[model samples]
Target: MSRPRLLLVYPATHKLGWVKRFQLPSLALKQVAAATPTDWEIVLVDEVHEDVPFDGNFDLVGITAMTHQAARAYEISDRFRSQGKTVVLGGIHPTVLPEEAGRHADAVVIGEAEPVWAGLLGDFLAGKLQPVYRAAIPDGGQLSIPWGRRDIFSGKQYLTTQTLQASRGCPYDCPFCITTNYFGKSFRYREPEDVLAELATFSGKLTVFLDDNILGDAARAKPILAGMRGMGLKWGGQANLRFAEDPEAVRLLADSGCIGIFVGIESMAGEHANHPKTGSRYSQAELIKRIRDTGVVVEASMIFGFDDHDEGVFERTVRFLEECKPSLPTFHILTPYPGTALFDQFDGEGRLLHKDWSRYDHGQVVFKPKLMTPEQLYQGWQQARWEAYRWPKIIDRVMQSPGKPVHLLYNLLRRGGISRPQ
Candidate 1:
C-alpha cells in the first residue's frame, strides 16, 4: 500500500572537484520529475555528487543521458536492471538512438517527456507499460509545462537551483546543433505570465535560463524581460549574438536582472551559423561592444576545426577574441554529434574516429580534420584555450567589462580550467 517510488539519475562521466559547485544540475531531469504523477514519490541521484542508490528501494528508475554521458548512463541502467529495477532511458542520446538505449531499458521515452511522461507512468502502474513512449515535438511558438519540482533537488549544490527554461527550440537549423532537429524549429515559449509566476517563487538571486536562444523571438522575449524588470534576480543564459543588433533589446535584457549572457560566434571561418546571410552592417566587434557596454557580461563562444581551418586558424581566433574582448571567451573543438547534419556529412565520408559517444564532449577531437590531423585539431583547441586565458589576456578582457569584479572572478575560474591538462 506504499506510494510507488521513482528514482531519477544523472550519470557522471568522471569525478568533479571544486568545479562541481558551478555545474548546473540536470534541468532535463527536473523537467522529467515535474511531469510525474503526484502519487509517485520522487528521488534524484546525480552520480557526480553522490553514489547511485542501487541498494535503495525503488519501483522505477529514470536515467537521462546526453551523448557524452551515454556510456556511463548505460552502465548505470544495466546495473539497475540486473537488480530488477524497472529502468527507463530518455533525453537527447536515447531520443537520437532509442534502439541502442532499449537494450538496457524497460522502456524509452523519445522526444520531450512533458506530454508522454504521465501516460508512461500510468501504463507502468497498470502493468501495461510499452517498450517506448514517444512525444511529438512542439512546432508552435507557445509552451506550457508544469514548474519543475525543486523539492527533488533539496540537498544539491549548483550554480543555482533557480534554473528554468523560458523557451524551447530554435528557428535556426545550424548544421552543428541538434536543438532544431529534435526540439523543433521554432522559438516555443511559455506564456510570459507562467514564466514570471515561476520566478516569483525562487528564493535565490542567482538564476539561469536553459534555453538555446532565450531572445530568439523579439516580441515573445520582450514580455518576459519586461515582466522581470523589478524581480531583483541576477541571471544568465545563452542566446544568439545577432540579438544585440537591436539597441532596445540589449537595454531591456540588462534591465531584466541579466548579469551575463552567452552568445555563439560559432566559427572563425565566415560560416558563423547564427548570423544572417545578408549580414549586418555592424561588425561582430561592434555588436559585442554594445552588449558589454550595458554592464551585462558577454561570453562569446567560438568553435574551431571547420574543414577550411588550417594551422593559422588558432591565431586568427585568438586575435578575434582580442578585438571583441568579451568578458570570457569559450573555445570548443567542433563536434559532429549524431542527429546533426554535420554528423551525417562526416559519417558519410567515414571521417568519424569512432562511435564512442563518450569522446563527443566537444573538448575532444573525434573526427579527422579535412585540412589537418586530429592531433593538430586537438592541440590547436588546447592552445587557443590556453592562449585566451593567459593572465594578460584575461586582464585585458576583465578590464573591458563594466562589472570588473565579476568578470575578473569568472576569468580566473576559466583560467584554472584552461590551465588543467585535458
Candidate 2:
C-alpha cells in the first residue's frame, strides 16, 4: 500500500544569464504540491538550473512549461510515458494548446491550477483523469500557498530566494502580449492582509515580485506598499509606466523598498505606438521622469522591427535611451508569440519567418521586416543591444540613477558584455 509518487518539473528554456543564477522552484509548482494529499510523496525538479535524474521511481509526473520550452517538455513527456508513467502537463503553453500537448500527456490542466490539482489527483488515482481539466479561477476565499520548498533551490547561483505575488492578471492587453490571454483582461488582487502575511514570512531577504502589473489596483496597492515598508524588505518587479502617474503611488513604492521596476515601454514610436490593439498608456519621456523621481531604478524594455521602423530606428532608439537616462535597457525584436493578438495578426498576414519555437524568443527575428531585410533586423538588434550595453553608456545611466548604488551596480552587471566588434 505505497503512496503515489508525484514528480513536478519546470521545463528548460533560454533565460537571461543573470536570472538563471536566481531561478527557484516556481511558486505555482509548490502550490500544486501543497494542494495534493499529504500521503503522496513528491519530487520537484527545476530543469532550468538542475539536472533531471532519470532513476527516480514516480507514478505520476507533472510539468509546467512556457511556449519556448514546449518542444523539450513534450520530449520529456514522451520519454516518461514510454516508461509507463502517467504524465500531466500544465502552464501557459500547455493551457493554450492542450490538444497539441495532449499528444504527449495523459492530462493537461488549463489555466490557474489550484482549483483543479486536488480533484485531478483524485481522478488520476481512480484512473479517470480526463485529457483536459480546466481550472476555475478561484473565488475570493482561495488561500495562496506560500512558497515553502527552498530545499529544491539549494546549490543555485543566487542564494536569496524570495518571491510573493500580490496580484494576478493585467487589465491592459497590449496586442503583442499573451498575459491577458492567459490571466484574462481583468486584474484580480490578493487581499492586503494575505499579501502582507506572505511578505512577513520573508523577514529580511530581497524579494522579487512576479506580478504582471503590481500597481494595477491603486487602492489595494497602497496598503501593500505600506505593509512592505513596514516589513522593511528590499524588492523589485515589473509594473507599467502609468504607475508613475500617481505621485503618491511612486513615493509609496520607494518607501516600500522597491529598488527597481521593469517597464515594457515597447517602442518609442513605431508599431507598438500605432498598433490598433496596443493598450499602453504613456509616452516614453514623461514616464521616465516620473519613475526617476520616485527613486526607483528603471529597466526599460523596447522593441524594434515595426513596419514603420527604418534603418534609422537603431540610432533613434539608442538616443532615446540616452535621453531617458534610465538605469537599464532591454532591447528586443518584435515577436508574435502564440495565443496573442499579435500572433493571430501575423498568421493572418502570412508574415511568420518560421514556426521554430526556439527562435520565437524576443532575441530572434521570426518574421520578415516590412522596412528592412531579416539580416538587417538581426544586425540592428545586435547593434542596439551593444549600444545600450556599452561601457560608457552603462556608466552614464548608473550615475544618473536615483535608486540605491547596489541596484545600479546590479543593472550594470546585468547588461554586461554587449559591445559590438570594431
What candidate 1 gets wrong by more than 4 Å, as runs, is 269-278, 420-422
lDDT of each: 0.89, 0.78
Error of model 1, residue 29, in angstroms: 0.8
Off by over 4 Å in 2: 14-19, 136-159, 269-271, 274-283, 417-422
Cα TM-score of candidate 2: 0.91
lDDT, candidate 1, residue 6? 94
Which 10 successive residues of model 1 have the least lDDT summed?
269-278
TM-score against native, each model: 0.97, 0.91
Residue 279 in candidate 1 has what lDDT?
Answer: 66
lDDT string for model 1 (192-281, tens) is: 999999999986569999999899898899999999999898899998888888999999999999999998887743644343421667
The prediction achieving the highest TM-score against the true structure is 1
